[model samples]
Target: MSFYDVLARGDDALDESPRRSRTWNFFSHITCNTVVGLSKIVLNTLYNVEVKGLENLDQAMVAARKENRGILTLMNHMSTCDDPFIWACLPWRYFKDLDDIRWGMAASNVCFTSKVTSRFFSMGKILSCERFGRGPFQPALDACVRILSPDNTLDSEHIFHGLGPSTDLAASMAKNLKEERNPLSPEYKPPVLRKKTSLLHVFPEGFVCQLRPPFNNSMRFFRWGTARMILEPTVAPTIVPIFSDGFEKIKPEKVEESAFDFFTFYNRGGKVTVNIGKPLDSAIIDGFRDEWRKLCLKYTSLQDSNRMSDELKFGEEAKRLRSKVSGYLREQVSKLRLQNGFDKEDSRFSDVNWWVKYTDTKGKSDPSVKFVGLNWACRDYQSNVKIYDEKGNLLQERKDALCGPKAPRKSH
Candidate 1:
C-alpha cells in the first residue's frame, strides 16, 4: 500500500497477526532483545544511569497481574529515544515476557512515512497516531483503550469502517454493520473473549519539549487523549507515573541538525536518571470514573432517538472532564519530578488554555511548526507567544515574538 493509504487508515492498515504468530514471535524475540540489549549497553556503558523507585514498578506490576488489571505508564517526552532506551532500565523478566512489554504511540507523519518504517515501528508495537489532523480524538487512542480493557475486542473492520479509500456502497455497508453492533442498542451483543491485560506507556505531553536550562525538563500540559484510556476502560488500569532526565542530552534537539542524528548517540559520560513513581490511588481514579459514567448517562439521555456516538454526544462536559483528568495525571508526574530533585513547574503548565493558545498559532506565526504541530525549530524561553481570541483580538503578548526569524536569541 502507498504511504498515503496507510496514513489514511491509521493503525488499521497494519497487519497485527504477527503479534500472535509463533514464527513472528521468534523474530520479535531476537529483534526486541537485540535492540534492548544495545540500548542497555548505550545507556550504561556510554553513560551513567541511575534508577529509583523501581520497587514501585515491581509492586504495581505484581498488583496489576494479581488483580487482572491493565497497566498504563505515563512519562515525560524528552527525546525520541525515550521509549526503548528508557525501557533498558526495566528488568530482563519484562523482556522475557513479551506480553508485559509496552505498546507505544508514534506520530504517523514521522514513523509511518514509508512501508519499511511503518512495518519497523509496528513490529516494535508502536501504533501510528495522527498527531495533527485528528488531534486527541483519533482511532489510535480508541485502540489504546481497547488494549487496556480486558475482554474488549476491536476488529480491523470496526476500526477502518468507512475510513480510507472505499466505494460508496462499501462505506454504507460498513456503517450499517457498525450500527447493528452498537453497544447502546438493546439487540446488540458483544463477542465472548479471553481476558487479557495489556500494558501501554504514553508520553501525555504528546510531543518533545526539551526546554532551555532552568526549565530543560519542564513538561507541556498533558493532552486529553491519555484520559480516554483512564476513564473508558472496563477495569481501571494500574497508572504509574515516571520521570526521567538526561535522554535529551543523549538526543538533544539541535536547531540546525536533525533530531535523530546518529552521531549524537556516540556521546559518553552523561548522567541519566529514571524515577518510577507509585501507582496512582485507585480510590481517586474511581471517583473520577464514577463522575465520567454519570456524565455519559446524562448526555446519552439528552440525545435524540438516533443517538450519536459517545465521541460526538459527550461534547463540552466530557471535554472538561478529560482536561481535569489529564491535568491531575500531569500533576502526579510533576510530583514525581519534584521527588527526583527537579524544581516544581509553574502552575500555568497545568492550564489547558495556555497550551491551546500556543497550539492555535501553530503554523500561522511559525512555518516551522509543520503538519505534526510544534517541533524544536523555535524555542522561545524568554517570552510568551502572542495569544489571540477567536475574534482576532489580542489576548496576550510579550516583548519578544514566539517564533520566526524575528524571535529573540537565547541568553546564556
Candidate 2:
C-alpha cells in the first residue's frame, strides 16, 4: 500500500507485525539511537539539564516490570522537543532495548504529512493521533489501551505464521485484529490471554502551553483520553506524573534574529528541570476504577440510555466522574510545579471553559494577551465550538455566536 494509505489508517499504523520486520527493526534501532543521541547533546551540551526524583521513575519501572503492568508517564507539553529530549535524563540502560522504550503519540497532521516523515516517526515508535478531528475518542487512544495491555496468547509464531514478506497482508491482519469492548459495557470482558504490557508517555495537555512568567509552568486541562487509558485498561497502569521546565526557553514560541543564532542552538545555556513524581497511589486509582465499573453497570441499566451515542451511554454522571479523575491527575502535575518553586496557577485554570471565557472578556481588554499563549487557546476553543445556525441569518445578526447545535457536552 502507498504511504498515504498507511497514514489514512491512523492508529492501525502501530501494528506489531511490520514493526517486527528485521529490516524495520534495524532502521528503528538506528533512528531511535540517532534521535536520543541528538537529544543528549541538546540537553547536556547546548543546555544545562537538572533532573530530580529520578528514583521515582526507576522504582516505578521496577514495580511495573515485576507486576507485568503498563507504565503511563504523563507530562506537560512545553515544546516540540519534549519527547526524545526528555528521555535524555534517563540512563543508558533504558535505551538498551528499544522495545522497552516509551511509545508516544504525535499529531498526524504535523508528523505524518509526508512519506519520509511518516516512515521516520513510525520507526521511532511514535503513534499518529488526531488532534482536533477525533479529539480523545480516536482509534489511536484504543491502540494505546491495547499497547498497555497486550494479549500474550498471540506469540510471534501466531502473528507471523501465514504472513510472509508482503506488508500489505500483514497490515490487513492487524487492521482486522479483535478490539476490546467498551469498558463501560456490561458485557465488557478483560482479555483472558493478557500477560504483557508496554510503557506509554503522553502529554495530557494535548497541546503545547508556553505561558508567561508566574503561570509559565501551568498545565492545560488534562484531556479525557488519559482517563480512558486509566479507566479502561484491565489492570490499572502505573501512572507517573512528570514536570519539566525551561524547554520553552530552549525553543520559545518566538525566535529573534541574531548573528549568534547560527552558532548556537535555540536560546543556549537555558536550565531545564525535570522532576518525576512517585507513581500515584495505586489504592486511589483502584478506588476510582471500582467506582467507574459500578457506574458503568448503573448507566447501562438506565431506561433512557442511548447505547449508540457515547454521550448518552454513561450520561452526565460518567462525564463528571471522568473529569474528576482527569482533574485529579492534572493536580498531581500541578503540585510538582509548585514543589519546584513555581507559583500556583489560579484554581480557575483547571476549568477548560475558563480559558475561553477569560479570553473573550478580560483577555480582549489587553492587546498583549496573545503573547502569553491565550491566542492558541482561543483558536482551539473556536475550532471545537459547533454552531447550530445552519442558516446565515442568525450568524450574521448575532453579536455573539454563543448558540451551539445543542448543549455543550460536559468535558470528560
Candidate 3:
C-alpha cells in the first residue's frame, strides 16, 4: 500500500469508541508478546540499547506490587523507537512475570489510523487519544486511570474484544483468526493484582521533539494534559522520569512512511541510552504546585490581558502548570544525561531560536534538508525520489518526497 492510500482512508480507520471482548483479550496476550519478542532482537541489534537507573523502575514496580498502586512513567519523546527500546533494555531477566502490566497513551491518528493497527496496539496495551480534537486527551487518560485503579477487575464487559460487529466487517475476521490459530488457548484474563498494579507511560510533550543533538534544548515544555493526568485526585501513580538518548540516528536518508523504515532504522546499529530518574510522588508534586501556579499565572496573564471565563481560566492555569512540570522533568533528564557523559554544557543548543543561534562549527547547520514539520533545515537542493508500492512495484517519482513531517516511528 502507498502512504497516500492510508491517508486517504482516515474516516474508515479512525475509531475513538470503546470496544471489548473476552476471546480477543486472550489472543492479545499471545500476539502482543510475540511481536514484542521479535522486536527485541531487532532493536537490541540496531540500537545497542543500554539501560541505567534500573533500580528506579525496580523500586517503582515493587511499590506497585505491594500497594496495588500504579506507576506513571514520564519520558521525552524523541523517536517512535523509545518504547520498544525501553522494553529491549529493561532488566527483564530479574522480572520474568512483569510483562503485561505496561500500558501507553498513543496518538489516536498515527497509531490507530487503521483497524489493523488499532487492534495491534490495543492488544499491546496502547490506549489511543486525539491530539487536537475536543476532549482529545480524556479517553486515553481515563483508560490509564481506570486500569491503574486498585479495584480494577478483568470483568468480561471490561475486556476489549475487537471492533463491534456492526462497525467494521473485518473486525470479526480478525477475532476468528485469533481463535482459529489457538483453539486450545486458555481463557484470557488480564492478570489481577491485589492492588491491580500497572505502569502508565506517557510523553508529556504530546508530540515528538525535534531530532536535535543530544543535551540540546530541543525538548519542548510539557503540555498541561500530562500534568492533569498526574495530579488526578482519584489515583496518583508515582511519577517516574525516563530519558532516552539516540534514536535520531535511525532516521533514513529519505524518511519514508513505511514500516520497513522502522525495521531498517533499528537494524542499522547505533547506541541508545535509557536512564530512569527518581519518582516524584504526591508530596513532591505538591511541593512544586504553589510555585507552579505562580509561574503559570504570571505567564498566562502576560500572554492574554483580557479576563478569561472560568473554564478558560482553569485551562490557562492548567497549561502553565503543565509547563512547570515539564520543565522540572526536563532538568531531571538533563542531569541524568550529563552524569552519563552523553551531554556537555557547551554542546547544548538554546530552545529559543535554535536555527539562528546554534550553527555548526563553521557557523552553518547540516546541509541536508530535514524532513518537514518544524525542523532546522540547511540550504540544499534535491530531486527524483523513488516511491514503491506494497508489492515492490515502482509506483512514482517525485522531488522532495521526503521533505515532510518527520514524525517519530509509531510506538507500535
Candidate 4:
C-alpha cells in the first residue's frame, strides 16, 4: 500500500474543516516524500553519526512483520533533531520502502500564534494547540484519539514526546490507548487475535532537563508512565530503551525546521550515536525501574562522564540543563519545606543557600565505581546523620548543614 494510505485521516467533515484534509495540505505526498528523500541525502553524508541498535531493529521488525505485530521503541528525548536523525538512520532497506520511516511528532502550540507555524507542522496528523490542555481541552484530545487509534491500518507510527517535566507522554499514551483497551489498561478487554499495525517512539526522561559537570548523569527513574504501557496486559509492544550519547552536545534553538532538523551548518559538528538495547519484555519494566536506573547511570558514566564536564559540547542544551538542574535543586529544597518560613516566594529561589548533591564515587560497596547523590555537611554538623554509599563507608563527613541558593565555586 502507498504510504499515504498509512497516515491517519484528519477529519471526515470536509464541509466543516476543508483545510484539514490530507489532500488540501499543499505539502502533500510529493512534498513529504521529497522531504524524506532530502532527509536521507543530508543525514547520510552530513555529519559523523553512528547507529548502534539498527541491526536489532531489523531483526525485531522481521519478527513483528511476520507475526503482524507492532513495535514501541522507547528512547531518551534530548534534542528535537535527534528523533528525525534516529528515524532517518533506521534499517529502512528491510522495510521495502523508506517512506515507512515516517512517524508522529508531539509539540505544543507554543509557536502556533501564526499561520506559518500551523502549516509547517500540519503535515503530520496532530495539530495540537492546547497550552494547559492537560485538564479539559476536547479538540486537542479528539485529535489525539484519532491519531492513536488501535485500528492497525489507520496510522503506522506515532512519536510520543512531552514538553516539560510535567508532560507525560507515556501517561497520555497509556491513558488514551487504555480507552481502547491497551494491554496495560486496567479495564482492558482484549480482542480475539487481532493484528497490530503501529510503532510507538517514546522518550522517558519527560523533559530535556539540563545537567552540568560532575553531576551530569541523567536522573532517569524509569519508574513511572512507561511501565503502564505494558503493565495493563491489554497491549504490550516489544519495548526498546535506546541510549543516546553525543546528542546533548547539539543545542535546540539552533535547529531550524526548514533544514529538515539536521542543523548541519549551525552545529559546531560532532559525532552522535544511539545505542539501541534489546527489546524489553514489558512486564519487567514494572519492577525494573531501580534496576534500569542503575544500568542507565552506569552506562552514562562509563561512556560520557568525561564529556559531561565538556559543557561546550552541549551548547544550548547545556545552558538549558544547567538552568534546569539549578532549578531542580531549588525545587527539591522547597519540597524539603526549607523556604516556607518566608512570607511570599522568592523570585530568586537560588538566593536560599542549599548544598549541591555531589555524587562522590569514592570508597563504596559497589567498590570504586558507581555514583550516589549527596549533599556535604561541615565536620561539626556531621553527627547522628551518617550518609554512606552502597557499602556503609562514610563518603563525606560534614560538620554543619550547608544551606544556600548556590553552591560555592570551591564546593562543587
Maximum-lDDT candidate:
1
Tens-place lDDT per residue, model 3, 293-391, is 344334323222222223322455555555566566666666765665664543333242343333222134533323333332221122233444422
Candidate 2 lDDT: 0.65
Candidate 1 is scored at a TM of: 0.75
**Error at 206, model 2, angstroms:** 0.8
List the candidates' TM-scores in order.
0.75, 0.74, 0.61, 0.46
- Per-residue lDDT tens digits for candidate 1, residues 276-324, read 9999999999888877766644443211212324543247787888888
The local distance difference test score of each candidate is: 0.66, 0.65, 0.51, 0.37
Off by over 4 Å in 4: 1-35, 91-99, 111-113, 125-196, 217-228, 231-234, 252-269, 282-412
Residue 379 of candidate 4: its Cα lDDT? Answer: 20
Sort every candidate by lDDT, greatest first.
Answer: 1, 2, 3, 4
Q: What's model 1's overall lDDT?
A: 0.66
- Which pairs in model 2 have colliding backbones? none
lDDT for 258 in candidate 2 is 38
lDDT, candidate 3, residue 296? 32
1-412 in candidate 2: lDDT tens per residue? 1111212232253553276466777778788888898889778887888899999988898898788678999998887678888998787788777666788898765576778888888888788776542555555776676666544313223223333435454443344333322232355433211234677999998877787755666777898778877776546789999999988777665323334432345778878899999999999998887776556444332232212134422357767777888999999999999878888786766886775465546365533433342233342332223222311112222222423222233232
List the candidate 1 regions with Cα displacement exceeding 4 Å.
1-18, 152-196, 258-260, 301-314, 359-412
